[model samples]
Target chain A: MSEDPGSPKPIVTFLGPVASYTHQATLDAFSSSDFTLTPVVTIDDVFASVQSGTSHRGVVPFENSSNGSVVFTLDLFADLQHKYPDIIVCGESYIAVQHCLLGHPDSHHASHPISVSERTGGSRVGSGVIESPLSSGAVTPTSAIPNPQKPTARPVGDLARIKKLYSHPQAWGQCKIFLNAYLKGVERQDVSSTSRAAQLVAEDLTGESAAVSSVIAAKIHGLEVLARGIEDRGDNTTRFFVIRKRAEAEVGDATSVDRKEIGKDEQGEGDWKTLVSFTIDHANPGSLAHSLAVFEKYGLNLTSINTRPSGVENWNYIFFVELKGRREEGIEDGPVNKALKSLYGVCRSWRWLGSWENRLAR
Target chain B: MSEDPGSPKPIVTFLGPVASYTHQATLDAFSSSDFTLTPVVTIDDVFASVQSGTSHRGVVPFENSSNGSVVFTLDLFADLQHKYPDIIVCGESYIAVQHCLLGHPDSHHASHPISVSERTGGSRVGSGVIESPLSSGAVTPTSAIPNPQKPTARPVGDLARIKKLYSHPQAWGQCKIFLNAYLKGVERQDVSSTSRAAQLVAEDLTGESAAVSSVIAAKIHGLEVLARGIEDRGDNTTRFFVIRKRAEAEVGDATSVDRKEIGKDEQGEGDWKTLVSFTIDHANPGSLAHSLAVFEKYGLNLTSINTRPSGVENWNYIFFVELKGRREEGIEDGPVNKALKSLYGVCRSWRWLGSWENRLAR
Candidate 1:
């Protein structure tokens, strides 16, 4: 909200340690010059930083192409409408995820750093980097800077020499085919996140351990890349949401409703997406079907849907539904607003999570 | 499929290490005297045993109320219709989950094992046991028996005495409230599962660690339940499905179709639940909404719905839909058969995972 010329750059927090896919998303969401970026350890911390007004914006991984919903993020939205009155999703970013096997620069061997293209079926991982976004003075001296351990040891041997592999639990599954083939008997040790995995490898005095992390992480942590694009699929990607506080009256909905002024694209491709989650009388027949049909009545195309436990009872679920609305217009002027308005009558309880520009660029 | 009175009791494989929740679910699914129980470390192994015909049946945790759909299980069914033909879900079981803080019984406080009912807000844990299910001749001599490390240490102090806490990643979230209030700042070390956490505690000779595990695991590992019923919710439960290979053609669906042979109950109560997953043309605006509408056409009540990455491509999801059908009717005789029959026309591609009696027993 404070992008005025010469205004102090507002801090944008993300789930990170400077090299996670989420960090990649933060750089993509707001131009580096517009805000000062910082890292938080968890998704909850990202939201808390924004919720408490400690951070101006927050970027969180909403879902992954292969792993499905980041339920932890979704679970945080349960009763979020009342819990955090101002935070709302403002934009989204897509990160092309390519995991690489990283190791201590001193422990791993390659004679020299080689581009992946030199190997069979390998592609060059863009030495993705963020030049001084965090190191810049835009961040206050009080802020903790990421000061990674510099590698001082000499080079060692190949994959066969590695005894233990450190990785976030999710990475192991995504890179299973490669792990089973090349590092079959290597011991896997799970860390909390990919950033942590890389950090662990950087700190490993053993030189016998490695990790699966982003190429950026390898660079940030001063580790050497041992293998590139190890994930099962070449097109693996993660989607994220950029959030900031929204003042209610600034919403311009409720009182002065704009009926039928949807801007530009009528087709689904460029339409904005609105996400809302709710619970219904699951015991009653046709409740969910009827709830879904409401999207059809108002001509809102349903794009994605998911379910999570509501926490109140066993088997009772809360459903998250996303729908596409014409982009150029205010949501109040499109089927999204009308459909959400009607859900009050249809759902047992509901919360409008957020609406954001459909910036799903690959 | 071979539970003949004189036949070698068929091996029923489950995801486990003796006293995990899946082990509990296995005990509930099959009468111990009728089958030999075995433990496989991963969910994939549970399915693998059944698919390779190495085991007679398999039991896998399907979903947990607090944790939602076990995506691993859901993803396993993506191409299951053809990949593992005949391995159909036949029965279901519910396991009430209550995680306890367990430590080496010798290094634990409390001169005696006190019932949880003695604590401020505690209740008695059932001390669930599967007396020698794994040890009796029910299992083959070659099967690896759970031989826990005998704790030769002696009693220590209270929660403050815990130097480190061990738990499965999921258990950490479920007991956050209790952990924060009592064991704040204790180092948490994650294990593969709750059972592994218990086993590690049993093996700890230093007597400085504790684990969040099931009461049965505490008993089986010769550990003390330092604190019981520690999960945030009292009624936390996990639902599981039992699968076995059915001889083709034994399925009475196609030829003599039970089209009109509806069972006694037409109401939702006591109705059987059918689960199916399908993909729709995501690019088409109304494809998903229309696919869901098909269920309404057949008047089937969708009891549950979940979406997982189809894995064929990014964001192309496979939806798992469960609907209720009359108990006394064959799936072919009720709306489930009719709805699934219609899905082929509505969805881009579909797979019938399995159907079983709706056993949402608390």
Candidate 2:
């Protein structure tokens, strides 16, 4: 962490309270630098904070393991970048999330119970209220369910059949496929936080709804979990990011540690990549073809191109892309440069978000 | 709907009971055809039934208004394509869903009950145990909190204050950015289905967890709804597909509908699109890039290219792509086809999905 004595510390904004994962990711990314953290309330705030100068840089959610793309993040960034040219993604990081289910002590008959009965699956469906541990008043479970299955099957007497489910959206999405398969016909909903769901569930005498949240949510919500590790995908993780005003200074072996942990093929000559986003001028025929031709001419390989509705009326778009050699003078640049030159309109722009190799060690 | 007495009718499977929106969509899409309707136990069963030949066609989720892509459907298709060469996509469709919250007659307690309090922002959060005409036994209020500002908030009264949320994983990812902003600090948990979460919460009297699910989840689960229209993004609708071993009969008006929907002018000429999938050997450099170059040389425009990890270790990959123009030779054929031929072994194989226009309006 560099201490820039002369410069004002960079103000970094991210989603959350002190315990929020995004906040932790922000700290992890900028902890060594002369940057100050300003936890914001939401992902939109992260971008807004930076745009408004409330914070030098804003960090927020982008994508997840189970879910393909964080459409909301994409929606916000694409608009912000197109509307506001001043802002750019200087860097990004992928953080994994660890999730846990929470419930109250007596909510479930046993401390740890699994496989709620099929009949009771529909029991937990809505948000419930219970007395709070922190506050003098009782707190409601953000979600709860009534126990309906034969008590003998579950072994736990108080364990409620989880009809309702609570957790962050990402958390829910990752485990959805499995949940759909396992619970079959159960009700699920989204709440403010997992803890609130836990708190509410904790108050329930019947083990109906199970909150697929974090331990923190469980603690705050006062719910004792009936099941754990219920996610469909074993690799139930999410990647988070940290944004800063300026790039961080090189710390002792940090970059190397990152690279090593990610397990990239350092030996392979072409294991690196570059991601660029661009818009084409009024969906012209042969225009994109010609543009892509340039990359071929320059020997630049094209990787992936995803097209989405541009949100602009009468201007639905096609996002053409290419993944190839690094941008250098000696590389074949004829076709690529020509393609760029041939593109039309000031509306077209591109930004590189950096290249990363698939480094997860098997 | 046409039912041919002489010919073997194609079987088209849907998500559920006849009145469901998906079922309606299937009927609308195949109303003119001779087909049999097969109701599956679950969406997965729909896919399985199609693959296993138990049903000629199966309807499954594809995309949504609020959510970007129906990942499970994608995952299923991706997996099937990767595993079985014959499992191909015949046609596609877009459907919309409308949701409502309901409760049992006994749970509807409009009066200020002792167990709960007023809602926040004038909207009651406790939809729990509301005694309504909808059910027999316990009816949960969809909105428990009539006024959130009341200083005397009970732990059981504040179902709306729920920060922790739970739902199907896909729903969470689709609503990621929205949840990150509006409901920050809320713990997110993934369950089998949003419906499951809703069901569990409805049955539980103790409050804590909140589920982000369909309105049906609230009613079926016996829980109260604190709020509605909670998707991170509005226009929250999902597209479902009815896939079968056989394609929809080439009847009437469909082509016109497709052409009208897909027709667009680009580069002062009309252009239609075709979606294709292919697999390329992983070890070879410039293999996939080389294939793309084929399109470039022929002046054929490539719209989108999405790569799915083959799940097979390090040797295979599946690429879902969209390209301009049909397969018949027209523009430049030699170079393009040659490029494809050059990477024969590297290019495991390819399948054409369909070709239409840039946009498919619902």
> Which predicted model would earn the best TM-score?
1
Docking class of 2: incorrect
Predictions' DockQ, in order:
0.45, 0.18
Stretches > 4 Å off in candidate 1: A1-7, A80-82, A106-165, A181-192, A250-270, A326-333, B1-7, B80-82, B105-156, B159-166, B180-192, B250-269, B326-333
TM-score of 1: 0.78
How many pairs in model 1 have backbone atoms within 3 A of each other, for residues 3 or more apart or on separate chains, i.e. clashes?
5
Cα displacement (Å) at residue A41, model 1: 2.2
Sorted into a CAPRI-style docking class, model 1 comes out as acceptable
How does candidate 2 fare on TM-score?
A: 0.61
Task: Give one clash count per candidate, in the order shown.
Answer: 5, 191
Candidate 1 clashes between residue pairs 3 or more apart in a chain or in different chains: A263-A328, A263-A329, B106-B154, B106-B155, B107-B156
Residue-level lDDT tens digits of model 1 in B99-180: 8878863323334443333421221221211122222212112213232111111111234346778887778777766666
Worst 10 residues of 1 chain A by lDDT: A147-156
Q: Give lDDT tens digits, candidate 2, residues B312-352.
A: 43224466655665433434354334434444544677664
